[model samples]
Target chain A: MTNPTAAMLVIGDEILSGRTRDANMHHLAGELTKQGVDLKEVRVVSDEADAIVAAVKALSDAYDHVFTSGGIGPTHDDITADCIARAFGVGIDVRDDARALLERHYESTGLELNPARLRMARIPDGARLIDNPVSTAPGFTLGNVHVMAGVPLVFQAMVASVVPTLTGGAPLLSQTLRVNRGEGDIAAVLSQLAADFADLSIGCYPFQVNGAFGANVVVRGTDGGRIDAAVTRLAGELGL
Target chain B: MTNPTAAMLVIGDEILSGRTRDANMHHLAGELTKQGVDLKEVRVVSDEADAIVAAVKALSDAYDHVFTSGGIGPTHDDITADCIARAFGVGIDVRDDARALLERHYESTGLELNPARLRMARIPDGARLIDNPVSTAPGFTLGNVHVMAGVPLVFQAMVASVVPTLTGGAPLLSQTLRVNRGEGDIAAVLSQLAADFADLSIGCYPFQVNGAFGANVVVRGTDGGRIDAAVTRLAGELGL
Candidate 1:
């Protein structure tokens, strides 16, 4: 069976403004690959409603799963929950289950659930809440879209909670052969190898270290035997 | 005048497949911010032709400038040039200028300019070449889309070459105040400060250190005086 396809929507002005470097995309990409889901595309947009709404809707429609990080905090810039609601045409309000989660956490911490903190309980209609072990604010899953936090720890916890529930295909297998040669030197043979291994994905990643050029040829596919075979053929052809 | 808007397209499956962490995006983001250009959106797509073409066309039409990284090598997966040509409906060929640059570099390095290496000279019709100081192969600009290499060193050098030619607006200025307070505690006052200083972008980033919650409030705008005033008011309101 074909692997489930996914897309990521990273919403934050700080990331776009270059005030912060995003760690969530790389984390999610690695996790999704391990879960046997094909992450097709990733879009990072600023904290604007129109851009967020359009991106959410487009990605949600195009892929099997849509994972979003950022803009879910209690600050005024936190507009992701509202955008998701608008995109799905659902009315959002402070749901009892989510409110209780926040209430218990705050009560234990000797903190009051102020109006701003209460914003974390706002969930769209008919959505399942994703657990956040790192923080109290709960992310919700409405349809195929998963709304998670921007914080790396919280986002990763939320992803760990969500991926197990998803049906995954065969795990992608890959083998890499790092050759001490320039891409131009290996291009001809690599292209022939790629054509021969039509079902596999043959990728050439070139690198330069200490003024010497080299390339790492990676062979990836679902079948372990095919990847192994491709790597062997590649090594023999390159005389490595 | 408002800042020129830009979008970045990061190509290559290594990034999407979680095999490599992308450093080029962060470098570009910081550089663009310094150049007084607003990087509004970023899309990470694989080396697929249709996906690359679609992203190039969409970003080029929506923003003032589009910067693309990856898939410009001689390998079969390096299809960015072909995709860019298709996106603009232009023919591509080994232009004389680019080929001559490669020939001279190869001659000096004592490397054969084989057919595979010669593929790097392909340039779309009417496109101007962006010099790559790190490598002999040059990046090119077709309309507003700049096709750069996947290698971080080469990509950065190409950006440095291209950015100086474009007109820049006022440099974005920002100030930050780190407070030992949770987001919930500052959300109310921060919201008011944001409203009062509508011209500035007031951002609150929360962090948890050693089980204690704290936040860094950043005030950003083109006007220095306005940002300072907003920061002063915010600090006073927060009692910090």
Candidate 2:
């Protein structure tokens, strides 16, 4: 069977505005790849209610699982939790368990669990909390969509907490051969290899390093043997 | 006047497979921000025709300008040109101008102008070529979408060629105030500052530096004076 498909919605103006270069998407992409989940699409949208809700619905409907990052902080701009609730037509409010967790963490840290901190306790109806070991503020998984924090450390912790629980297929495997030639010189052979190994995804990423043209030919599929064969054949053909 | 809105479509399997991290998105976002072109959304999809076509249509229809990177190379998987033609229901073929550019560049570089290299000459009908200073292969603009190479250097070059041509509003200005407090402590006052300066987008990005909670409050708007005023008000209100 094919791997479980997934999509990610990155909700934050910082990313879109060039104020921040997002590390979360790259981190999640790597994590999901290891988990054997196929992340088909990733959309970065500014933190707007309508955009978040629309993207959540579209991604949730299209993929087997949806993952979101950002817009969960205790600030005025953090509206991802509310937007997820609206997307699924679920009622959301401060949940006691979440509040207690935040309350306990804040009390121990000598921080007040004020209204702003309390916003972190809002949970959508019928949602399970995704544990965040980095910070006490928890992320929640609502139906097929897993909502997580934007901070790299917190997002990684939440992904670790949630990914193992999802059903996964065979681990996605890949092999690469770096060719010391332009993509133009390597394209034809790569194309033939791609056609021969139809099940595998053969991609050529060309690069210019030190003013010399080269490319990395990556062959990916669930079957490690097929990937090995493709890489071997490519290396032999390229005489590399 | 509101800045012209833009969206970016990143097409590749390497990115989805976690083999490569995209740099073009961040580069374009910064470029557009400086140009006063509001980058509203960014979507990363694999090298699939249907997904690429659907996203092309959706983004093209939604935004004033759509910038696409990747899938424009000479590899067999580089189907972006064909997909763009199909998305707009237009015919595409190698144009004389593009072919000549590639022919001259390849000849000068002593690389054979093979069929794979010739593939770069294909341009959708009614499209205008965007100059690529880094590489000879030209990116093209069709309708509202500007399709550029996935390579960071080439993509940035194409962006430079295209962005200056678009009608831009006032430059997006911003100033940040660093608060040595947790987001929870700063949230209430930040909310009031946001409301008071609704025209300026006041964004609070929190951080944990050496185990101390802190945040950077960024105020952005077309008017530099307004951004400064919002930051000043926020700093005063926070007693900083």
Interface RMSD (one decimal) of model 1: 0.7
Report RMSD for candidate 2: 0.8
- Give the per-residue lDDT digits (tens) of candidate 2, residues A1-240: 889999999988888989888888778788888888999999999988999999999999999999999999899999999999999999999999999999899999998999999999999999999898888999999999999998888888998898888888887898888889999998999999989999999889999998898998888899988898999999999897
Give the fraction of native contacts in model 2.
0.84
List of clashing residue pairs for candidate 2: none
Per-residue lDDT of B1-240 in model 1, one digit per residue for the tens?
Answer: 799999999997998889998888888888888999999999999889999999999999999999999999988889999999999999999999999999999999999999999999999999999999998799999999988998999999999999878887888899999999889999999999989888889999988899889999999999999998998988898887
Tens-digit per-residue lDDT, B23-86, candidate 2 = 9888888889988899999999999999999999999999999999998888899999999999
Clashing pairs in 1: none
Off by over 4 Å in 2: none
DockQ of each: 0.87, 0.87
- State fnat for each of the candidate structures: 0.82, 0.84
List the RMSD of every prediction in angstroms: 0.8, 0.8
Per-residue CA lDDT of model 1 for A89-192, tens digit only, reads 99999999999999999999988899999998999999999999998799999999999999898999999999888998987878899999999999999889
